[model samples]
Target: MDTRTVFLNACNEIANRLDGFKILEKGQRLKKSSLDKDIYFEIYFQSSFRNDSSSILILPHINIYSKILKKWQIEQIKNEYSQGLIFGNQIGYLTPYNNWKEWNLAGLSYEKSINEITENIQQYLFPIFEIFNSKETAIDFLKSNGTKFNQWSEDSISPLDFLLCFSENETAEAFLNNFVNHCPYKGNILKLYEKLKTQNEIDLNYSEFHGADKIKLAFIKGLKII
Candidate 1:
């Protein structure tokens, strides 16, 4: 049994049900822009064959984009927002639940797996996606939650990014320095701070940021107060 074919065929049926949805990544993903707002959603069924050939585990990875934020990111970086993959807050990681949904196509049959996954999309993901349809909501959530939104907190670099996103550069700089003061890998992460703490985006290493991380690059570069 071909797991990839099974996944793609199910994704095809899901795509047809959404009005403006487009199949992407050769049918591993679906993308749809909000009709009334500048937000967009992409739910990539990150699928892989299980040890048994007849089943696959799909982690429904979601992304929500704010076109306004993308514009700001691009205008600062002197490039298009993204000609490739767009990054949003990885809301899945923000939550505590396990995201993997298994489809035992051979055992469950195509009808059962497809309908169940579709229900997951509609009942689970849709309500979550609806809350983040604009930059206002995105910004509000980040600002309101502060450090709570990130599971790793100060141990991770996201706190600094979150601060920087809100233009709290002085606070971000202080936070990075404070984190480096306590980190075991101070030398390496401190080097990152040195590269990132500068007011000059031109002096920064462009080659280091790639793919989805380029969004981080744009956010860091857009900092006016750092």
Candidate 2:
């Protein structure tokens, strides 16, 4: 079988075995949403092109999302610079078992790769989906999963966003007091923090907010935190 055929076949096999996920992007992506449709676990394929035209590595990536947050993000996109924070979910490869990310699916290895992928989804991802199945659990998870917040991080979920989205202004300010110190780009976080602490509102336009502020402001405005 050709490399492309092997990739598609493996994806199809996974779709057949997995119960809830719906096929997307013509089989390149798999999406499983929660019963309430508030949470989503997206499994997708990535190709690692090799120098040898014969070899292919079909890397599988899975990430979780909140249906509410997704919609909130769309509402908050006020300008060209403002962007969505898509990491309502995160995965280290198909599963995050010990932060594991290893994939090799080319030619005959497709069967083994598919098996491993299915097992990882069952073993690691399903449990996570259950954990963050609701916005309440998801907010609590981000608050507890302290990988240390970096205000400069582009894609990483900042707990502040959750706080702002959920209108936890008091807690968010306390967090910002310390978090801003860690972020060298503290201008935006601090400004937002001070506004919440004193005025209880954010007046900055989406364009005025830079970097991680995009997430913070989105939560504040979209969720109407004031």
Candidate 3:
């Protein structure tokens, strides 16, 4: 009935429906571990303020540590690469409390808010679990759909990020080289190319880059050329 209770109930419902996933960190998060145990799918809820109303931000993210690649190796790709990667375009859902304000004003039940939260998980987050059940599947999904580094950011990891983690130095270099030719951010791309030319390993400090700068930095970091 309260916001926290409603959110926890929705998380519980999702956990119950999905096999192998259990709630963690109190009722705020849920995770399903991989065979390696270090890698997993993590879903959590955070509170955000926007548009003059409190909103719930539901995030579904993965943490991948490949047997072939050490965690540090991948972290070199993106400084914030602790969480594996996010798959597909439906990153997360932002459900606003304002939507339920009308019903609450009339003293009606908040079933609509509860149902909305549940549906958000079902429609946007549950499918991610189905698609990325395994490391291989997760990588394959990225290869097929993660060409665009449009929303590259510290908080969001892209498919291209995963490819760098799994690819060899020569392969990663080639991919970045080709991507730079067509990518919109020529200055940043050239900078990365220059860095890759001399160094085998590079750290992409996101703060150094802005706007499209982040996208190129991610490619350079992900490859970890050295």
- Residue 55 lDDT in model 3? 42
Is 1 or 2 the stronger prediction by TM-score? 2
Q: Report the C-alpha lDDT of model 2 over 75-129, residue by residue, as the tens digit.
A: 5544444232335333453243445355567656657878987887677667656
lDDT of each: 0.53, 0.57, 0.47
Candidate 3 or 2, higher lDDT: 2
Misplaced by over 4 Å in model 3 are: 1-10, 17-19, 35-38, 48-70, 74-109, 147-161, 167-187, 195-202, 205-207, 210-226
Model 3 is weakest, by summed lDDT over 10 consecutive residues, at 98-107
* Order of candidate numbers by lDDT, starting with the best: 2, 1, 3
User: How do these models rank on TM-score, best leading?
Assistant: 2, 3, 1
Candidate 1 lDDT, tens digit per residue, 1-226? 5777766777777677655668888767788776556667887776664534555555566666655555654554556733222233332443443332455555566678667666656755665466555444444544444333344222333334334444455555554444445557656543554566564544322544322233235345443222
lDDT of 3 by residue, 46-139 (tens): 4333212244434333332333344654555444444444332323322222122211201133355445555655654555555555656655
Per-residue error (Å), model 3, residue 159: 4.2
